[model samples]
Target chain A: MKKYLSIIVVSLFVLSSGIAFAYDGSLIDDTSYTGTITKIDRGARVIELTTKFEKTPKTWKLNMQDECQIQVMTTKDPSERGAFKKFAELKEGTLVNVYGWPKDGKWLARKISILNPDDYMVKRLEADAKAGVFFGHEP
Target chain B: MNKKGFLALILAVLFLAGTAEARKTEITPADQRDWQVIAPQDSDTPLRDYAMLYEAGGHDGNIGVIGIPSMKPYRYIKMGVDMHNFPFSGSNAGNNNGTPDGKYLWVSDKGADAVIELNLQTGFAERILANPKPFGIHHSAAMSPNGKYIFLTGELSGKMAKMRVADGATTVIDVPPAPSAPDYPDASKDGKYVFSGNYYHSAVMVFSQDPFKFIKEIPVGKNPHGTNFLPTNRWAVVCDKLSATQSVIDVRQLKVHRVIPVGAGPLHNQPDNFGKYNYISSFVSDSTCKVDLGRMQMVDEFPIHYRVGHNSIAPDNHYYVSQNKFSTGLFNPTGIVFAINFEEQDIDELSPTYGKTVKIVPINGEPHEGRQIFSTTIQRWNTGTGGDLFAKGYELGDVKVNFDEKVPGKGLTKRPSLEPIHLAAAKRYFIPRDDGKPGVTQEGDVTVVRVKAFSYGYIPRFIHVKKGAKVRIILTNIDKAAGLTKNPDVTMGFLPAGYYGQKTRLDGVRGMSAVGEFVADMAGEFEFYCQQFCGPLHLEMRGTFFVDPPGGTASLSVGDYDEISKLEYQVSDPSEREFITGGNRLLNTLKEGNEPAL
Candidate 1:
């Protein structure tokens, strides 16, 4: 009984302290941008996207390298890393979060995580309806 | 009294106190302003036809705002010559560059040895950024792609300066080969490098903007004048005036990739939006050549009237305006010298008049260059976030800079610091029924005069003072373009009260009051006017300074056409005047040939 109680206390303490030891799926970066791809220049290996979280919307052209990591998220979390992908699989209108820094006058991409559609507001509203959270308002 | 009645009286007292406190913090009907966001306009809108043209030459430096398509004159904004220490020498205003968002325009006043930043929304000359030591003659400037830095070129000083846009923190480097003159500069689209054309060394000097260091100088043809990078950020094409060819520097390799023959004296060049065609203005040949960028060769040429100096494509890529020099036979001849003309050529394939001179607008003074801006790019009002720290409402009527302390013996005398409340009350003096007082006050030996500047006029239409009195005129601008009207009858209308404040320090902070101090020496009836184009009544915003004579007697002098009529006049013969007018008409009728003329 004493051992069980001690284990329960430790578990509560760890959870209360907010140290979960789980990956949030965000990459380390000098600068980061999460936006939908508007254009893809194959010859230059550059993709243009309007920045998501900025007071003033700005178009950023990021250069993709061969060694850069490209992943597609599977979970509802927008930043969750899931499966590996190639540059050819990337398409316009796909939402992505990029981690990069300026290199040789170009924004060189270090990592690009293609966000899951369910993480966005529209898909989340539908998920909430399936869960019957909205009651009579659910469509 | 009963216990219940006494308790009710106490409750009533507490309720009254709470009501009094609530009224103190209540939002006034005027203060209850909710802002609405305006959607960005399309770049192809016809409202983007406004062009800003500048002349830094003989006839007094001024910026002319002209209309396109119709080719009509609107108004000219006088670049503050009477306000600053550098009185805008009518001969040395150089190149200008606007920010990516078009909120502010940076113009180089070489005569003042400073780079002036103008707030586009209010048309106010906001800040004067002085070139650092060892560098003089601030010639040209280019804004970075991200709008964070301004790359400045010094022609006579043989130096290049990089100024951070947020604060005017500057770093200077020599344009290598010791005596090279950096005439014109252009920042790369990727914001990595600044390419400057060196006239003396005949090379285009490249500098890394991040570390602010000289990278390399690629040898080009003789007299490299204007350097412009294509949209691809791969090639920087430089017009070599003396060699009559363009040196295309491959930015990826940092080498001169091709030297294509363009024409006689190619002075300036600009590439189209698609990076498909490049236009090079040939000064000696009186034509502009269009080069195919992919082929790296001159494909077509369009003849402009005479001496094509600078050329620029419109924002929508609908047409190109060729700034031609030496008016000659284009306009009505005034004297031995004539005025310049801005000739517009249609480039839009959808338009009926493609590759033709659609209109010609004659203008006074010698204009060096012109830039076209879409109205949507400029902010409706400056919020102090768009790199203009000295914008109105950012600093409320307080001048923290001491000009006399920085550069002593200059006209502005020393000013004592005042409290924030004193600065706030300075504007209230102009408004009656607010317990306000007159502006002019005597402080010790100096007479302090406060001038309240707003949209249409300045307070105190006339200032009367004794001769030799030390006068300090502190001009405070209280109007802001941030609020809406309270009338329910009118919708979507904003208050017309935006103006850029002057008096920015060298470090570019804490300039709220546009202050100037001078001894009233030998002053009769000197006139002071609002230089910025505030509104329709901007010309009416003028005031006179009346200084009394030595005997302390105020007097006035009036003059009329009678004085002019007494002077001898030289009249041209009627036949000579008729011939000149007929010649101008014939040239206008004959210059409209269908040949591709830009």
Candidate 2:
């Protein structure tokens, strides 16, 4: 009976260790994503955002981790940059910039920053207009 | 009869027979013979009534003449000048623009940095107006309607000059720096304004002809390669190379009025003598688009089998002749000439045989700028004082005669020898591909096959042969005629790494055939396709050439073939994918947005 119990314990420990190793591997090769937040699920610690890439709009879902750093830009001054903030402060309809690594079909966020939504949205619209003209389409 | 009487009669018969034979073999001096004179005829007579055609040899630096309708072999007239000798002279001889007086032909000598005037009758260069600047590449010449002033564009210097014909005085006018190379120059019918097309800039630089002053720069499409003005419509049509559109500018307003889309790589624009239709030839599309000036719309688009450089319309307005420049990939030089019959109201009414084309190799190289030498222009030279100058031992060669009787085959035909390909080692070749891997063949024998290329596709798309075999590919262009009369402009290219010594074998034009012989020194699957931009579906015109091992059954299956049998010829639009990417900044900007502060 003791042998079987030891076997079960070792198996659970090995499986958990594998899961940890995979999570650690996912932390490597970090990239960045910038977009407007479309949805936020606090319970799941997940945020869905729409980003424009190559004049093509794409949606990405990111998971917030415990060590993820957050910052917010509240001033319009070009030199002021941004100040540190909390992940809980992020909300839907807010413009966000994220840095993370992708693994197991999920984006693991390591850093998040909040931007001036109105300014970024206007810039995005202007870009879309220019793209439309280049593609022979009326915006 | 008595022995003496019989001998006398026999001697008389023999003498008569020998006299007849001598007359038959007598050779006539080319200059002494009076063939069809280029003298002016009745204006009411159609241009097709003329018996000859004149073409400018682009690299060859000679003017070639051939029989019209008969489509005979070319007879070359060497442009000999003392200032410019044969070995070191005649670099980049561009378009032949006729002088208003018809006594001389003006051509830009790019290498000599001079504009040369060739006397029409003597075939001798009468004057060489050297460019003051040493590095200027003289490209095109335009004569003032009054016939007193000659205008020329220095393509490399981005400058235009007006020269007085009487005294050879030159006044140079500086214009905006042409980022795109400046090519052809055209003058208004009134001779008030001259326009130069910037090949890379997609703009036309306008100037006052008399004073040689820059007036304005008018923007058109991407890569405006050719420009021509229509006095009847008071419009100038600019052929945009990359944009696949023709920008029509109001000559009076000096502004673009409308842009009509055309085939890809439109290189030259030639308006018919009547000013009813404007024809544009596309380099990449292998087709010619005819724009009806009356309706201001594209009426017809027809294939020319290869990239056409410069075109000339017959004065009688029965047909127009266009010369081929390069193969589809712009890698190989093509010396094919197309004679398109425009008099037929419908394509169906045109003859596929006699009315199509003749293949003639240029004297020095491929023919480029072509201009129709009207009978009126020739007559003026012959009857006027110009004839006296020509009579002084200036005429060079004779016009080619007996075209129908001397040459065989109709439409597109093969040359007697494949000398062009044998001279230049191919840069691309064909290898085999099998099961997503390089095909391996064990065979050591040579394999020979014939391939027929058509619009957007090739016959026997999948070819199976052994490795290390001497392979001979006989290529025939069997593409259907565009509409009822025009031959499909198409060329076949074979591609494989390290095959044919890294050379590409591309030959055959519409209605013509070429043979490619190579030792199948390597084994593998290679891809073959139409090398020239045949039409919109050109990308889909491809096939597989499988080289299998002697004992291997590694043949391409139906599932393995990328079948494009259903594709047809189409005009390709400019791709805007790069613009959509926002000039290589979108990806960087997106990444920068996620960068840590500062």
Candidate 3:
């Protein structure tokens, strides 16, 4: 019975250790490159990598047309359920530094520094239009 | 069938046919109620259907709501770009503005040094936040819970940010380093805890409150970049690019708990909404590892979605993974995003072993009253890139009723005095068209046909009205924000596909107003459509309208479309042969939009 219990415990430990320890080792500076932004409307919400390369330094308009993705990793209030909702309420000009690859015209953000965005506004945001066409309702 | 069986079928069909026929000709629900004065149906064309010339600056202004069937359906995606202040006022947009809660997209104009609000639903600007601190505001913004605030990060300015609606002012959370990092700061709840992994400083900093007073700075792996918190809010997974290590921190304890070595390092680490899991992505092998929270280990690894620039999930638990951007032909575009579902691994819905596949059927011509169904490029699939319609089918001027191999037919022979019987139809398909423009393409099988009411989305909510009440409506396909359309013309409104999705003032002091057709003359229920393809539920868009007679109930078969059209022509200028030609053309268009060979 003692031996069986030991075997069962050992198997549980093995099964639970599904996570592999990842110690990222990059001596090289991944400061910059170029790629397209896969998802753009993060506002100040950053993602991990840029998705495309337009191959230029000119300022690209970040809209739904442009692909941009930003990853955000931060501690929570331990209570709030919707983080995106919190991100949406941020004031303009909350600043941050960004390190990324630039391909074509857009940038695939590699690294970002959250800052005071007082002077900064959401880059490319617009309201959508819809027509309320239904039964028995008037324009 | 058999004689009695056939007769029974015919009787049932006829009864159902009577119900169906009555649906089109019956007076609107609002016109049938007691103490309600239902307006008479005018013989003249609807105000929205007629072209008008105005005096804009007294220079003969012309803005006409062109005539297209008001009763068909369409789909589209509309992004907002404020063209209201553009050099050409009328040329830049489709007219009208929207609220911040309405715009579902984000874009940064590096040139104007401004971050404007764009409408992905109609390709128009609802609002604009101008004169950014740095002349180079790129695409960056994050929303807090309940859409109260937004966070904007920029490279030119060195301040960690919060975007509040009041005064559009900025309250500095932290002083970020120069050249501003390429990424944006993601907020926890209520912008309480904002974070930025300063690559220059080689550390990740956590903030507290709105102004962002630093609580503690953790010395993470080299280039402590790409950080995210598990949905559980228990751990903060920081991806350090230099050491190829994911430094895990116990956010609650605010301490460096452990460091995990990810082979080839991680380009990104993502947390699920539940925050119980995190995905570490590797750009090199194009693979990802699923991290287990309990054991602090990598459990499973899978190939990336594509050249995998980034990935996300919809609220419905569907994954939207984007691939590399396009470069002519040699390269696939970043605009190519895929709808993937890996965790829902059961491939048995209808057939135990067969999984569901994406269907892209085209529109085949159908004949209605007089409308002619023609195969046009407008029926192609439309999305953001303008032209990526890989499917085809027969769609119409209104409802996107696309047929598969079989065309649906009906017993159109009219009759009276039959009891009302409803027909149950098998689910079919429709490919909606949004005026076939460059930016809008209404996709899928859901189609909205114009009824004399104001409504959209699924048909769960209804607006009851009285019969014979005059109502005007402007129908537009709205599928962009809902991710259902891919039409350029419909999205951009180059032709006749633009619309304003709103209900007329229910209690206004104009001709007549009420919350809905609540004062219905007759008592009955009616189906409504969102008309625009907002998403999978777009097809289910419908509503009910009740009209009660003077202390009576709504009966079957009132003066509906079939009856009204017949009555309308009687008052028309039948004396002129040319009038008949014009009427014939209109009738042909209607017939073509509906009838199909059985």
Candidate 4:
């Protein structure tokens, strides 16, 4: 009975340690996922995201870090970022790419890049359609 | 007593009548006549005796004669006889240079490829000699000092011809082929030799005045474009466009004696009346350099706002008039003439501050080569050589242009209806988005986009819309300067096809805006670009206009639409996943390596 209890306690300790190490803010091994921001909570410094990769479109909670980097990416112009901002700046319907570690069934955000904050994607899509590339034909 | 007195009165009346008849028959010999007294007065003079006339034509194909006073300080009067049958139609006036004889003015007509002699009184042109081949582009004409022959330089043919004034017989001499872009031809004071500058050859070709014989090719500097002979100084100054040097050749020896450095792209050099200083005009630097003949060095330089072309000093030596050729761009062919005051008695004379005293005269047309119309020979026809009269003002009427009033495309029925678009220009960029949002995506709505044209490129270089959509584009120029310190004038041109023609153009002045409207009716990809030579990378400033078919539903996504997979799709290719993962690793490594060592 003592040996069995000791084994179970050891196993639990190892699993918790693995979970904590995954969210230790090691950006080198961080996972990247692109999604749309569905909701934001300035009080809790958290955001609700929906990704195209998942069926049923579950709203996943993502926690922000004190050093989290938020950037705006441009197609040809240089990417602009590095200014300090609050969680309120990230609005709903904003397309973003999140880079962080998964912890406790949620993502701990290391960086979030706004891919089309100016809605350039809409223009680009229109251009593609005019070029017939969206319809899989040559213009 | 009454009979005797009547007889005496009759004899007295007969004697008076005989004396009057004798005075009427008295004639002066041609050799002893005071020809200067018969010379025409300066056009600017309130009271003038004779009128000096030459053929004047505009770029819009209007040809006529302009008359001015033959005396100093010449001014323009009304247009003289009009030439209804003048040949050749182009942007230039076709008449490049003109020389006035006592009764007729000989003009080198580049467009007609012929030498036309115009009757000064009637203003009608008659072909004195015609080129066997077309497009000779005759540049300048120099009359022999003895007035026996007129030497003309054929710019395109690289040949020089001596046409006999009396018989209209021409003797052509072909210079060596490589450097044969000959420009100005000037004769020696003794009328023994003629010298022409071979523009591409960087040399001066000498020919005998009488027979048009190629005497020798005297090498000078790179791209010798202009040659002028200063009779008082006995020196021939040749301006080299490429080397920025003046080859001062000794006329007696027919060789270059010294090379004096001048401003960049020194094109034409003219001497003051006393030959004290030679004024050199540079095309690339937009400045004029004054070279002291006695010192054989550049003594002073003055900035002329536009590119300096041919220049001439006033006969009184008080000031000089220079022609300015603006840069080649859309709707910028017309240039201005500037009179720079160089009065030596002024307190700020010949100093840099003296440029403030300059006067600008606006002119309609492209005026390049010009000269003051006063000549001792021309004055000799009026009175004796010692008469107190000097010819002053130039006849730039030989090169004039009237702006074409017709819009680029007036009768095209297939023209598209253009809406209004606005653009903003920055240094090296043209931002097309006005509201800080992406371009319009809707198909049926009016497409109004604004764009800014500046130094390097246009922002949002790509645009798309449905076919038959009306497009309006407004452009602004915000570039501080074009090159080092020159202000920029931007021109935006569009081409539905691949060639340049009657397309839409939006021209904007510095800190100003211009508007253009067109229809994106063509269902294809077209390019719009800067029309002017704005900067080094001006050709690369272009944007795409994409027109799609109606009713096609295109997905609007941040990334590539085709690459985006469905929600249920899983990563099937392991190599694809590896490539993406590896690319990110490489990017992180590079980003870390590029960081400064703190």
TM-score of chain B of each: 0.54, 0.51, 0.38, 0.48
Pick out the ten consecutive residues of candidate 3 chain B with the lowest summed lDDT: B53-62
Q: After superposition, how far is residue B500 of candidate 4 from its true place, in Å?
A: 20
- i-RMSD of all predictions: 22.2, 33.7, 21.9, 36.8
All candidates' lDDT scores?
A: 0.52, 0.49, 0.30, 0.47
- Model 4: per-residue lDDT, tens digit, B65-177? 22222222233212111111111111010011112222345555443334444433223332234333322445667765434456777665567766554434455667776
Please, what's the RMSD in Å of model 1? 28.1
Predicted complexes: DockQ each: 0.02, 0.00, 0.01, 0.00
Q: What stretches of model 3 exceed 4 Å from their correct place? A: A1-139, B1-113, B120-123, B135-139, B172-182, B214-216, B263-265, B318-322, B325-598
The runs of at least 3 residues in candidate 1 whose Cα sits more than 4 Å from the true structure, single-residue gaps closed, are A1-139, B1-59, B80-99, B335-337, B379-598
Worst 10 residues of 4 chain B by lDDT: B87-96
**Model 1, C-alpha of B582: deviation from truth (Å):** 53
- Writing each residue's lDDT as its tens digit, candidate 3 over B511-579 gives 221122111222333323332212222222343333333444432233132332232121113332121
Write the residue-wise lDDT of candidate 1 on B1-598 in tens digits: 7999999999999999999999997876535542121332111234434433333331223456566544566665554221111111110101122222333556664433445555454565444444443244445677664445667776655678776543455666677778777877877755567888877778888887676779888899987887987654557789988788998887767999889999887877766543446788887677878876656789778788766667766533456778776455667866433566778787644344556777777875445556654333334344545333222212111111111212111123212111101011112111221212437888999987666665555577667777778876666554552112111110010111101012110010012444455565543443445433233223234555566666654322422112222211111223212111111112112221221110
* Best prediction by lDDT: 1
Candidate 4: TM of chain A? 0.52
TM-score of chain A of each: 0.58, 0.58, 0.24, 0.52
